[model samples]
Target: MPAPPPHSPTSEEDIRWMRRALHLAEQGQGAVEPNPMVGCVIVRDGQPIAEGFHQRFGGPHAERDAVANVPAGVSLAGTTWYVTLEPCCHTGKTPPCTEAVLAARPARVVVAMRDPFPKVDGGGLQQIRAAGIDVQVGVCQEQAEDLNAPYLKRVRSGRPWVIAKWAMTLDGRIATATGNSQWISGEASRAEVHRLRGRCDAVIVGGGTAEADNPTLNARPPGPRTPTRIVVSASGRLAVDSNLVQTIDQGPVQLFASADAAGLQPLVDAGVEVIQFDSDSPSDRLAMVLDHCGAANMTNVLVEGGGDLLGGLFDLDAIDEYHVFIAPRIVGGAAAVSPLGGQGRNKISDSPVFATPQVSRCGDDVYVTARRVSESPPKSVSFNP
Candidate 1:
């Protein structure tokens, strides 16, 4: 019988190993913006040897850490490496990971997905092949793509991946007729929102929300880092005594508004950074906010809303993901505010479509997460793997 093909179908064990690498990659989630989360594992003689993950921006690539962790006397001459992303071949903050892998002399390499950044693209794969190492690509590709969605989105679109989050009653109202929206969801659901906030680069809210809620908007039980706070208003009229303005000493807060908005001088005097946009149109204002975020290298933004901002983002088709918490209670009133309120669609056919949502229960609330169906798949560098 003929020998098996060099790059045969992936084995169950190989898939398991790749999943482990992917999980390790997630450890770098909130810390590696503008850089994809990457994990690497080395195996020898059917047993694992070393494992490592990209821990922070401007740090050593995953491959370097994995290779460095190999037991002092273990030779990598016959070992195989499994990496969530293609080994990088170009230098930026650290040396090329491809060079590091070549130095270790691994016998074979398996990559979950090709790096989409122009600097590496398929160059890393080519370099590995040139060195006579067997290469396999596309192991656990879907999970790898999902893991790097934010970085890939930023690299391809020049804007952060936007996620809109809100908690509303079963009747779809965010607040009562008089704008009383103290606690819609249970503690578990609220805690989940804070965890989501902690993972993003910034949390945005409308000026109306700032004045009415006086929310601090910081992540409770903070993680490795806290997100920047952003308030958007056409007139820039935010309450001077609001908690957001009062917490300027704790973290950075930015106000985006039109150039002529009133009462901004006081905010500036209070040490709040004010960004002036050229237009007052909701769509234009959102575009300006995203542009500023991109310039600041912020890859993920959580738009925690008070209706107007969320409605504007939906009208502009700017939201990439949605996380809606639906509580069981109902408070019916003609003047009650819905989670999204604007000049809505005239016909049912004109409504925006979303992918099938993932729904789960959080205490007394149902959590629904979905992505906009119109979003383009992350750009990928073409390679056989």
Candidate 2:
């Protein structure tokens, strides 16, 4: 099971300050992947003097940013520090955040939660305690965990958190008889999809969707980071003239295929990296792709594949979250494609149940998001950076 919120109930003032720090943490989204989004607030006399967030990967951490922002004349000797995550004790691209905190000489440190990274799991807290500074943990912890779900999952499970998304009609049809799926949702919903893509490390599609939609798969109104575009195919029949092949320079494109698949030379010649696996099973192939992603330290992966591909991931029980967009129009046809396709549940009771469903509106479309309910926490795994 996931660890319980550390420490006893904190004061309301602590919760309020931690909530503000979490909000600051959210500002680093779309820019800080592989690294957790963290925020820090330096408080003196119960009032915030300065605040900062982890702005980008391999740059200064939140603690350093906050400490640096403190006024030149103002001393940090007696101030209190509120941070969304525990400060780092190990150095990677930057120095240890514990060094900064020790140098700042804060009287007390309040953290929303502990860092799950193996190297810094409890090392950060230990360092501060050793320095004779008071540390209070677990204030607004659940909110902080939700904010950094992708990062936490990546560290604990050794794989990217997968988000399965689709846009369908009220009747649950993703496409008509002829597979013409243009404009299922309104303009606003499509824009929201672009924003979603901006936050993920990669966007994946099946060969069928790639062949049909010819999507550019780039985030519109461009985000801080460019997500890699991936196409999974068993036959390896991607067209060289397709938009993905033509725009290789705009963003990274990767093709995952089975060994001995046909017509791959054209794609390879077009500068697409072809990754081959021995397994032909959809579930097995998906596992290999996820392993590849995990090795690359990708924190969030968005799956926008067609019905069959989505069904395969569902069968494997690999998806962590679902984003469904429901349009008002009804496309009635027996041959139409629904959201999920392969080997559906045998009984209604056998279907997977989701938790904490959130519903909202995007113009004329209704957007729903929910996480897959799990009986136990993900098995802990080690991922060395």
Best by lDDT: 2
The candidate that wins on TM-score is: 2
Candidate 2, residues 15-46, lDDT tens digits: the string is: 77888889999999878889999999999887
Candidate 1, 319: how far from true, in Å?
1.1
Q: 110-220 in candidate 1: lDDT tens per residue?
A: 999988789999999988888878889988887798888788778877899999999999999999999999899989999999899888889999989988888998888
Clashes of 2: 0
List the lowest-lDDT window of 10 residues for candidate 2: 376-385
Inter-residue clash pairs, candidate 1: none
